[model samples]
Target chain A: MAEIRKATGFIDWLDQRLAVNKFIKVMMTEYWIPKNINFLWAMGVVLMVLFMVLIVSGIFLLMYYKPDIKLAFDSVNYTIMQEVEYGWLWRHIHGVSASVIFLVIYIHMFTGIYYGSYKKGREIIWLTGMALFGMFSAEAFSGYMLPWGQMSYWAAQVITNLFGGIPFIGESLVVWIRGDFLVADATLTRFFMLHVLLLPLVILLLIAVHFYSLRVPHVNNQESEEFDFEDEAKKYLTGQKVESKVVPFWPVFLSKDFFVVGVALTIFFYLVCFHYDFAMDPINFEPANNMKTPAHIYPEWYFLWSYEVLRGFFFDIGGVAAMDIGLAAFGFANVIFMLLPFLDRNTDHVAPAHKRPLFFVWFWLLLIDMIVLTVYGKLPPTGNNAWVGFGATITFLVLFILLPIITKMEANCKCNTGGCK
Target chain B: MRELKILAVVIFFTAVVYWGVEPFAHSQMHPHVAPADFAFKDLGVNSKKGDAAKGAETFMSAGCIGCHGVSSQGMAAPMDHASASASFGVVPPDLSTAGAIYDKNFLAALIKDPTKALKVEHKFNESRPHPMIAFFGLGGDIDQEIADIVAYLQSIAPVTPMSDKQVFADACQRCHDIKYDKLMSTTDKEALKAYMGTVPPDLSMMIRSKGTEYLTTFINNPQKQLVGTSMPRVGLSEKAQNQVIAYMEKVGDSKKAEREDLGYKLIGYMVLFTLLAYAWKVKIWREVH
Candidate 1:
């Protein structure tokens, strides 16, 4: 291991007490990332920046936010956006980050699948990441309810009702979740508690696990070529950087990371200033009125794909309710990303997607399909739109089911060329 | 070439979603509720000229001050808010800036028939009639009387560029509150709820949620946007309506200018930082395989 810093005095004292130098080397300096990566990988850092912004801006909003149903809307819309000096800035930042983080997460997830980063020994990394994704989705949803507006109330109502499909405990679970029969003040407060406290705590712990898991498998590069981290660290330590296929995390990798971060921030601020409507729904601006339902109710853009899956299935199967099947499919869409590690058939011939024709087609089809679902999700589910939604929903499930079969064939054809080892 | 492929895909997918979700789906979901009409063409009121001095005199003889107050002229309503609310089903708004807020032609139509002027003929008909009685022609000629009253209001109204908050107060404060501004409705809550059938939504966030386009149409005629809402049309002249909407924007998106300015500054900073980062990255990558 390389000495982190040669400086004495405070450093010497800290190293003796906490092995600070060794820790820094392990965490940063000695961290070896493959050189054959791109800006997509920098999404991890962008997510980190967004999470921090969400926390900081959320704290500003929290100082004046009220959890009570009656006061919650005013607390956010009035107190935060209007009364507090630069309150709208905090709101715009928080909303944009909360929404943007999911986008980066989606890109990050697909980038992994593209490079087969989730395969084999890195399964835990993907699992922990998906866990983090779940936590993030939970966090976003709970934060969404804090405003207590028309879309907020109704979306919560419709989503919480899905838990009622659990058969015996279904009704009870929803009641337990909401602390009430309907989405009332009790539901608002609990969601507020989850949004502000419990969900974030879980997310932080999951993030720690996610990073630690990444230490072993490391980040996948644009190509699937693996590197010996120990050997790469030796090369980096000896300043054989030009000869090494990896870069040290600190000055080398981070310089590239900073470039990506800068570009991301530029986009983020542009949206925050100009196109913030993407994060905020106009219907949500109206205060929660349980008596009146909005003509068309839809989830945020991030959840639209899965939401469409839920709304798509309208036919009965063996007397089973069509919606129950749709609910299962919705649950499956969310859970399938984590299952990618197992579904890819542990292919030895697997490189990047472009090298594998079947996987390449599947990846693009999946991407386009999700986007289609998202678009159709927002439209009224009538006539041609419903048919399109159904088609997209079926395609989404079929693609996932088809993953292992496709990868199994690729594994066989390439492995047969050698020893199948 | 590889990076271009990825960028191309990203752009393609983004265009698909943006095109589908925003303009395409948005139009389908929320159709244009009402067309813009600055001239109040549908109100069917005649144009006539009147002297401001004559308007001031006739504004009194017309008995408008009986229910409504002329606060600018030191005349108060015959009854307080609650008493008037109980009697009239809602508090009659003060006419201090009625000329400033309401459209002259619409005011003419309103004075002729409160139900028709408000465009709530569908909701409040002969049986379930409106609370306020028609009084466009209080003396003799309907158009002449309306012209005189409107001239009176125009003369009394504060000139353009009064604070948005003040405009909101003069127009909306009688029925709705901007709690962010610490301004409550003038009428009692129970009375308002009883009259309107539901409490009016706070205007603090209206600019953000409903937006300028929807608000303009809705304000122009409530029935056009929300078909059966009990909200009466408060006729504000063009400048005053814009001012009222501007005030809502003040409370809803107060830091818009600052946010926009900061956005540009941040983008500038990021561009510079990214350039430096690119330089550093090139230097670093040059030292890598």
Candidate 2:
């Protein structure tokens, strides 16, 4: 290793033995980030903090929570609230944080879409993020069932039953997932393992990869020109000339990240302490009853958009069921989202929001469509809601399908008008 | 120095949010129910089976006859609709149809402490004029009395057992369309919508969509179930609520009972994993300052 800077005393000894200073200097102190990054950039740090809060509070909740059908509801409702010291606080933190994390993630994703963070070299970062999102959904769904409330039981039935709409092996697949003929102890136990252990571990690993890929490519900022940090690093390493306007990761970005974290935690703790049930459903207060289903079985707010799409197709085509087709369409939409980078073949390295007019327009439209779908999803599928959902589903498809073509057209139009640099 | 000042300001703001806005937010979040209250499912079960014969005695003794009467035969506040309406603002509906209108749980709640139940269970305004007071007075096996009264009310009316289709048509078809064939004229529908301020929801899949409990409570009193709803308090008896629920269930979501149960083993696994995760986090971060 090249010793570029001098150290003394205990630092000198540790440096010689472990290269701790070099690692810190390279990864933290000397690391460069874009200067013009906005509050949206701070969401990455917020997500990390939320992850920590969830895990910590989850551990405390786990200590008192019972996994039996008979005892699960009581454990959460009575034992956790009344018996365990500060148990409500921990439970509230875990519960509220789950929804808040998704809220932050949605904003973070919107920011990415708007800035075209998924363009070119940042594909791996985007892919890892999408994978994390998939894992986070699984984690949230599995965690939701842990309360074993009316919503949890019915949601599990509704979601698992969606698989049974698939052709041929659907029934067997549903049984396989549930570990029985229906949602029972086996399903709960398995979901428990997935929620607390497997999915979280996978999510954490994906987050690590996401960060690493992001660092290697450097942060996407509000600039048209792509800054090649790797080339600059190579020049600087070889003692050659280097010229790049950048801010150090420490002090500059770290302070900003910390400030965001502090504000987020303030709001988070406020919710945990006071408005704990802000996003919670009242129906979930009832224990899981196999004999009676609630009037409406809706997923958490985040999953409502997709749920609306699934409900839009209410008619069977030929021999296949409407639900089966809807599930397939829903799955296809997710696949398209995961493969957005490939779908959008734009090679332009512009990160400025205005530079990508087509993407900006389509992205905002898709967001509005999602919001409409979410509202429609919450209502009972009848009258105007069905029609609205149908319209939104069509709009959603058009946005994704036209993204590539529109962007290409916009690029060509820009070049012809002498607007391209 | 600037960083320290910023940090201090953030800390102060966080503290202010925690102490000031948080209490208000916390109060708002739990507006629906307190943690100490019994869960909704727990409220479903009746401890003792109610006897109609015994319930009749309790009903009269409980001062139910003062405001309400069976049919037009034995009455207290002049059985005429005009007089009844003048007394209660909205006519105190006859208990003859009560057996086929209200839910047993709702009846018990209404009879025991009408004001409290209206405010808490039905989410009615506290200032709203509640005609019925606590019939059971201070206490002593109030549950049994309420149950008996509910049984008696159930026995009196619904003389003709209407089919599920008949009940739905009579109760819901006027406002909500189940089939496209008997649809209301567009002019009438628009006038009705204008009057109500919102179009009435269809009841074809009401049971399948809303679930039995929601219907049970909502049918008892629309205002109680959802405050500011245009739907007036129908004043259905416990028996009526049950009959409507039964009919609705038959028409839709009959297999609701088949939903599978969930378990608690997940929490145990989570605890084990949490410990492991904590240890791992500690192990990984041990080298860092």
Q: Pick the candidate with the highest TM-score.
A: 1
Instruction: Give TM-scores for every candidate, taking all chains together and pairing residue i with residue i.
Output: 0.92, 0.61
Predictions: Cα RMSD each: 3.2, 17.2
**Model 1 per-residue lDDT tens digits across residues B61-146:** 87888888887789988898889878876788888877777777887777778887777776677887777777745547767767
Model 1: how far residue A206 lies from native, Å: 2.0
Score residue A419 of candidate 1 by CA lDDT.
18
What CAPRI class is candidate 1?
medium
Write the residue-wise lDDT of candidate 1 on A360-388 in tens digits.
Answer: 89999999999999999999999989999
Error of 1 at A217 (Å): 2.9
Worst 10 residues of 2 chain A by lDDT: A236-245
lDDT of 1 at A220: 79
Clashes of each: 7, 18
Docking quality tier of model 2: incorrect
Q: List where candidate 1 sits over 4 angstroms from the true fold.
A: A1-8, A415-421, B51-63, B71-75, B136-142, B145-163
